[model samples]
Target: MMGGKGNSVFSLSPNPNHLCISMEDGSQSSEQLVVDDDDDDLPPIDDTPDLDIDLEEEEEEETRRDEKCFMAPPAPGMEFDSYDDAYSFYNSYARALGFAIRVKSSWTKRNSKEKRGAVLCCNCQGFKLLKDASSRRKDTRTGCQAMIRLRLIQFDRWKVDQVYLHHNHSFDPHRAHKKSSSAATKTTLPQPPLHVQVRTIRLYRTLSLHTPPTHPLFQSSRRLELRGGFRALQDFFFQIQLTSPNFLYLMDLADDGCLRNVFWIDARARAAYSHFGDLLLFDTTCLSNAYDLPLVAFVGINHHGDTILLGCGLVADQSFDTYVWLFRAWLTCMLGRPPQTFITQQCKAMRTAVSEVFPRAHHRLSLTHVLHNIFHSVVQLQDSDLFRMALNRVVYGCLKVEEFEIAWEEMIIRFGLTNNETIQHMFQDRELWAPVYLKDTFLAGALTFPLGNVAAPFIFSGYVHENTSLREFLEGYESFLDQKYTREALCDSESLKSIPELKTTHPYESQMAKVFTMQIFRRFQDEVSAMSSCFGVTQVHSNGSASSYVVKEREGEKVRDFEVIYETSAAAQVRCFCVCGGFSFNGYQCRHVLLLLSHNGLQEVPPQYILQRWRKDVKRLYVAEFGSGRVDIMNPDQWYEHLHRRAMQVVEQGMRSKEHCRAAWEAFKECANKVQFVTEKPS
Candidate 1:
């Protein structure tokens, strides 16, 4: 029981459920504290139901705090060694009370550089993107004003200076406040802003794994298309220029400012072409691009019998004018030197362009394309197998002109293809595809590069498909070249190790085994082996100066004849026409010619018979390029000529020994050192 005195004096009993009245003398009575009867300023207790308070829980909490001293946490005004310790203590206290805590403010001493005091506060943070008028301000800021201010009492101990127990906002027990607080404190490094992190994640996740790491993610995520693919091509060409200084890239724009043509050649490709450009396999069949554009690749055979990339082009169309422009661009890039023989698809535009741009070069159609076209045309005919068999024999089996003629005539008559337009056309252009016609040329058996174009029946039979972007396409192309180069290097190393102390039966063969690559050497070895079966039958004179010998290959009762032209002089020149055209097609001497060379007392293979392209050291040949075009004048720049002369002199003087080289190096250093003094003296 409690009693009210005047207006403020009152006392409470020990029972939490009831308020007992008491006098100032501390005596309890069965009476309640009530408002003064005369004071009309106070409302009646029964009328003020909204102002009711829960004092019973507070009294119970205080009683429990006093009873459970060991189990309960330290009471308020507790001391700790550091701010983190104080924060950690309050964090546990706040967790038990069902609320989140946050650092409100902190300060440190200017002189000692020690953290002085920290004010801990309730976490009133909230989200406010919704449109609730009453909840808007509350969502932004709780304004709870409940905090504990801690200060340094002793030098190392911190004491709770002030603790505001009252809060203006209600505690949300269902919210994961502790988890949110821990996540907020986990980051020690500065993280990117929210918007930037969101964008980065979106872009990276949107990109496919097949996309290159260097791809521009921003543009890809935006899903924007380039202006006729010009921007993509420009970026790729610029990157190529940076990575390969010797690379040549040229682009042509149409009247509408769209990319019409593109051509590119790398240093390795140009160097390879400088040696192997004698027989080029020009292929426009394998056009790998998303734009359905014609991407032609110039392929050449290396000594290892592998196709090496010489150059590439993207043309607008397969028209005569477009091909002319492309061919001219390639010619300019290659300094106007065209291949001796051209092998390509049977397209009129390419044929006309080759005749006009490279008139002296022999033009031949790819036998594979011819066979494919023929097969497609005759597949509908009755007894097509017979016709196909005969066609294959005429195209591939016949080794002589007379044999090919007789086989082709029989095939036409037996298949009733004399009236067929495709058969007639093939026969008309037989020389362009027949091996017997081009047998003498050195093609290294490279008829065509089995590449496909997008516009065709999707003949990506080689597993190389079109690319979506210019960079991706170029990357695929470069990777293919890298793989080929590595394979060829490995082959060269293995072949070098496999050679024995004495590699061949004859002196010339032994010398060639050391000079040529394994592939070329093997081809030469076959020719040398065949020489034992070949003999000179008769001799004839051509132009009254060159003597031609009819060499015959005899086996039991059968015999075959070949013409060998021998020019006997201080510099002997030997040539053969065995209908195989092995030397003309492969740059290697045939059996008939080899037999003649042996009979003529030639101790070694003459330098005239050896084309540098087939040699193992072909890549060492120097190929000159003058910007984008050729120059008519030799040593156009006097400074380069002077430098070359000086270099040659130094090289000659230092060729004796390391001592001579060292002396030259020291002299060069002394001369260079005097330049600074000479420049400082002026004029």
Candidate 2:
């Protein structure tokens, strides 16, 4: 018999008794066979299994081929006892066909978070997620449509709802089988070992400072595609959870199983947001990684007037859908509390998303944007800077909503902008973006962006930059948090010990200094200094108890009129409000109201005027579920603060006697040496 692959044919040689088997390789072999009468037919060989053949191996190969029959794609009615069983069935099919599969996504019922169905697809089915220049895997995703859909059926059974087998790229059995790339990575707990775990960690440490962390498969000098690309990302998240269990992350996946957006907030970030979440500022263009994924930072102002990152997300694109996902995820992470007010970071998508997700949320554009648009987007204005400054004054110093409306109309007419679409649009949306119109709400200084000379969030300007990889971005984010938290800790210490000189003889200054933070005290001092701008006050009308005054105030090169109402109806309460809306806009007393109080001989700032949000000794409500700081990963500030108090106590007791002092110093040195030795010791 001729042993070869493919079809074979038999032929007779010159010798009638011999039979020849011709192979496709052009080889001829013969075996003796009995010919029938008249030489018309040959007898078949005796039916027998060859003793030399491995029947078990043959059976296994046959079984594998049978499983590969599913490559025609599983039938829609195919049923399984559980979702895992369903996944395993299709995974086996993919294994036999030589490709990878992953959970594309899971669908949940409307108004619920419970997953109802699962969509699994080829690993390389979706468009490339990251835009890394050196990524070899960029072309791996050929938009393969090979996938399976699993639906939860009656009696808790999972059934195949759909199957697609067409592949855009050629696949073979040798392709790595990544059946459990991301879902199987549950190393959130401390596991002793993974494949080459120690070696990978050592390599990561050596290269991480200079280069971005990459998959172990891509650690070579030459770029290589990741095997189970998202496995590493998921592992990274778990590793952080190992240190900080309160690290909240939500990922949005494409239909083809690609990660589209990711949002994260740590325990500390949650605590900060609870205090500062009233006003959120998000900028999508803030920072980017090596892959060019847009880093969206949700930031807020701390009591120190420093910008703090409240939450962060990496979006595939700044499209409407992506922003909607970001907003929803952040809202969920913050426990469904929408920000009272927000200023978007010059992206229209953000604004649109905020409106869609949090429709009730009051959104406003920064004064900077309105001015910038007039100066750049509009060109008809002859004195753009002059007009901008004039508009800025009216918005800032105007006492009533009517005053702003009149001033805006006057500017349009003066600039011959009656037909200008820009001015007309601004007028149409005045109630939406105008600060004077939004004075009744609490903003907590949301309006002071570029105007306040506030510094940018530390993460964007200092920690991360262009060309940062996912690994590097995370590391930089951690470093960013560390630096900011450290600064705040230090500032807290300084504020506790340092005292500011009195800017005024009024007792209100002393009261503010005692409760307000040093930064806020300076803001209060600015308002105190502006009291001289109050020209005079004339009584408008008095009902023997309620009195109103029309006051003149100096603003730049002009004098503006403001009305302040003082109601002394009840001796227990002296109700007052200035139409300037400074207190409501900025959470502090306006200069106009302060001027009136000063003239009335009132010495102390009202208790309501001092906001708890800006109080120097504001208490923090920490949700331990948001992470209580595991023993291994204690907060550095807290550690230092507690240790410092103990050390100071030791120093105080030791100073009582020379012998005690020597003993304390010696013990400290010995403890330090031991700690140093333990740190230097290797695992």
Candidate 3:
């Protein structure tokens, strides 16, 4: 056999019976096979001349012929009886080749009689049959055995191995098999673990002069308790610093050198701290030495009567900036929003801090401080009534802006105080103080208490003996006037009086007296009128039944009587009727005659005349039912319950109705089922 161009050729030589192959380039020659096919009786030849002959082709073929050479092949070792045996053989071969190999068993079988099995090779690369059949010599002999029927060819070499099985199947058995005998192999790298980091933060200073009662550091030991006993004091001081720093400072003034007594600070510092601080103090005792306690807290009622707490802390004496900074920090922490109004007794420190921290809040001087200054300015007014009057007008009266200006000018003139620098200084700030007196309502009652107290003693002092308080004087005055008017109406009979109580024995006498008194005056006027006429005789009668008058008129001795019957009972009854028509029309009475009959003790007054105009009875009206049993006019409870029960029944019956519908639907479906679907031919 010869391969195409430039290939080695194999041929049989006649002389030596050797198979020889020549390299296509004629560079080498080798013997491949030696065969002894020559014997004397081998064959008989036909001695006839052939029709065609090619001598040149025969000579060329002889020249190209050469002995074929074959190298020694691999030896056939023991066949693997099972995949495990095949895997062991391949792994050993791979190890020798300096490469690792793994094999997995795919399927297994065993018999009690023979102890034989077959398996599939499942190396990493591809699947292959490891064994057709294999046997164990004895039942006790336990070893995996199989035959390997597949091999891998790679490069110029071939590898034989069992296939690798993953979960019961081969995984790339072909690659594993091909690489089993290879010198080069890939390796896997190891993986690393992940890492994370965290940090902590703190918000405020943790150290304190006083630890809380529940501090974790203080366990059951009394020593810990003693060490942390100052914690409560420190917390109290801190709270004082937060709520009212100035009050805290003022209290500290009395204890000069003591650590708890830092109140006697420098004048400048004290003044700076005092601004708006007076408003924070509920009472003057907060500064007094009477209470020895280091911490004091109380609510200060402002002009509007709102309670504000005075909180103070006693700290060791510190610099002005240190105190101010501490106060600011305390305030910012304690009050989420700044104070709306701040009053002080002219302290510089408070004024400075308030201006900076609470610019929007109203800042004012305490009225007490202002009054003290005012007394000094008006020393001459101690005894003068005119001076007192002027003070009252300017400071306590219902003084308008213009009126106050006039009164202020009069005071300056009357007191001869215009040239006095002190008074001028006071008047210079008149606009601020003037509002305190001019307005009826003030921001703080504390500021206006002196003026209001002075005005109270004089109001409603004359005529009325009642010593009414100024606060309720107006209401009391109006009530007193109402009682006085009621007394005056009782003394004067012409004016209406409250109804007189009636007695069963003479029930109608009082009512009759009222009516008869009115009628007698009317009858006297009619008799005078009759006497003035030429026909003069007239009889006037008032028996409390009704007013009656008869007039006699004569001409030449012929006389006629003219009678007038005024329906008093009808008019009185009409007045008592409750339709209020009489009150609406003439503000008095109507002609319902039942009142007169009742007043005279008549049991059964004629109803026809009493209710004449109102004879027709009003029909009773009712709401009508309009829908089909949906609405009801009577037995509302039964109606609602009936509807509710009917709704539930309808819902319950819906399923049965639906079932009936479903049965009909199924019948329709059966009819539809009977019709067979067919494809029709087109025309």
Candidate 4:
């Protein structure tokens, strides 16, 4: 076994009988010797008591040192001794750690009576560590560290921040081993790990008392569950929904958790909401009632005949052009076709619009309108009873062209209206309108009946007769009224006293009868003039030539004197030059030939004139030929019957025999070819 020194420095020899010894400082040489038998039998010594005593002394020394370090009293406003002191220190320390702290007065203790009560616990304030820091700042003392925990509490409650101090102690190699003391310097501590639990603060504030939260006006359920801080409420009112007057009312009831000013709602938002169907109805009446201008309403009728409001727009000043485009677009959408028949008052604009959009459709002037215009014009002319009778004779009843001519002449003579240019123009286009009156159905009798006298002037310019029994009876009845109520007696009546003086007739008791008779004739002349002048005739030549003709008044009636000269070789080429200027000045030719022939050239009519005078259908003569060397001895009806029977026999024979069928087929093909050839030939 080695001595203590040798054993501590190196391992002993494994021989139990050998002994090795070395000096502690290694100055002496190591020596090895045989072990004594007597030493081997000696017992092992126990050193447990000695070791326990040494450890007890060491612990005692450490306890004394710790007590000495903690003995110093904390400075004012500093906490060092107790947990309360530590908590107070922590309150400021946590704020320095970037944790926002809120203190409540009552939160410090749970019971009012208890002085050493447990600190009311709550969530700690949170802080985030900076990404980069200097080495000095990042030192153990300088780094971020949690010093306190903040607790949230209800109003009127106290708040507290708890803190813990962290200290650093280590031996330095450079310092001498001596008993010494240095004043401690305060240093920033490292930040603690962030708290895992986070609590969001919510607040409520009353915006307005008038628009309360519980008010029925704030009926939108969507407005109730909004969540956010004061800033969020601001965004909701101003940025999101926009605070209109309506919305402002709703906002007034909102209790803001995070108090913030409400935002204004713009006019744009009001306009937007106003148009959402049932939300608000806009008033556009001002646009409609601005002027006395005429507006055409375009209404669309569905297949069910229900009208749909299409649109309303300003009417153009030029009515005709505007209506043309408007009605064209309207009809296209409604009926899928332009209107074929248009009935309207005698408005020039309406007429033009009809011609532009529905040229092919028949356009009829309202009889009521025509009559009204005629009545006004008739009031301007003054005539007598004969003229009145002649005018009535032509208007109320349908008569032949010759009768119309005779009545017209008589009316002009009686009225002294023969030299009136306006009256002459009225008769200028009689041919074009004569068909309308002669065929009563043309106007559905609206222009010819009970209101004949009233509607005549407006409808046509022509003669009317008073020969009917009804007219005669009315005349007798009127005479009886005149006898029973003389002018003086009529003037004295209370009903007549209030009546305004007649425009055309003076209130002369002596001339009342004459004025009444003159009024009738004036009305008759007006009707005749209006109807005759309504249309102007333009002659259309076969070769595409056109010319306008106006009726000329000779004395007081329209008259035409013209001679038609034909080429001897080409009688078809005829020229007509009327002393009335043909269609150049007036719209139509007058009948001077009838006057001349009836008065001076009777039974000596020219051949060319006779041919021209024939009716349109009678002027043409057809010559028929059967075939080469075959006379056309067949009567049209008999030949047609024979052809039909032959066709039936041919069909029967074709079905019975194949030879006949083949022959029939050949004949049919020949007939088809012949027909094709004929169709291809020039006229």
Best by lDDT: 2
Mark the regions of model 3 whose C-alpha exceeds 4 Å error after superposition. Answer: 1-299, 302-308, 313-330, 347-350, 380-389, 419-422, 436-444, 449-683
| Per-residue lDDT of candidate 4, residues 1-683 (tens digit) | 00011011111222111011111211112212222112112111111111011112465563343222111111111112233333333332222222212221222232233222122111121222354343343222222222323222223221222333332222221110110001011112222211201101111111224555565332321121112122333333333222221121011111111111111222222222211111111111211233221222322211111121232222323333334434443332222344333444454455555666667655554443443444444555655444445555564333345667777777677666678654564456344233323232122222322333432221111221222222232234224324433542333232223332333321121222222223222322232333232232223333333222332234346532123211222443323333322222111222332222223223332333322111111211111111222222222323332343345446545753599899988987997798687754452
lDDT of 4 at 40: 19
Those runs of model 4 whose alpha carbons end farther than 4 Å from true positions after fitting are 1-319, 336-340, 347-352, 384-390, 419-683
Candidate 1 lDDT score relative to the true structure: 0.56
Candidate 3 lDDT, 1-683, residue by residue in tens: 00010001011111110011111211112212222122221111111111121223464342222101111111111122232333333333332222223322222112222112222222222332235125342222122232232221121122222222122322233333344323122222121111100000001112234645465432221110111223333333334333322222221111011112112111112222222232332222212222222222222332112232333333322222223433443342232344444544333444454565557656555454555556656677655556656666576542245666787888878777678776676666564444433232223334533323221111112412233222233235335434543542332233123233333222233433233223222222232233323233233665665554444444356654544333445445411222212212221222222233343355543332222111112111111111234433232323443443343333333433578556656755775676555555673
State the displacement of the C-alpha of residue 138, model 1, in Å, after optimal TM-score superposition: 48
Q: Decide which is better by TM-score, 1 or 2.
A: 2
Order the candidates by TM-score, highest first.
2, 1, 3, 4
For model 4, what is the error of residue 346's alpha carbon versus the real structure, in angstroms, after optimal superposition? 4.0
Q: Which stretches of candidate 1 lie over 4 Å from their true place?
A: 1-231, 287-293, 381-385, 396-403, 439-463, 466-472, 491-504, 532-559, 570-575, 599-603, 617-624, 627-683
Tens-digit per-residue lDDT, 100-183, candidate 1:
666666666543456566767676533333455555333434666666766665556565545566667665433424334444
TM-scores for every predicted model: 0.54, 0.58, 0.24, 0.21
* Cα TM-score of candidate 2: 0.58
Query: lDDT scores for all predictions?
Result: 0.56, 0.57, 0.31, 0.29
Top model number, TM-score: 2
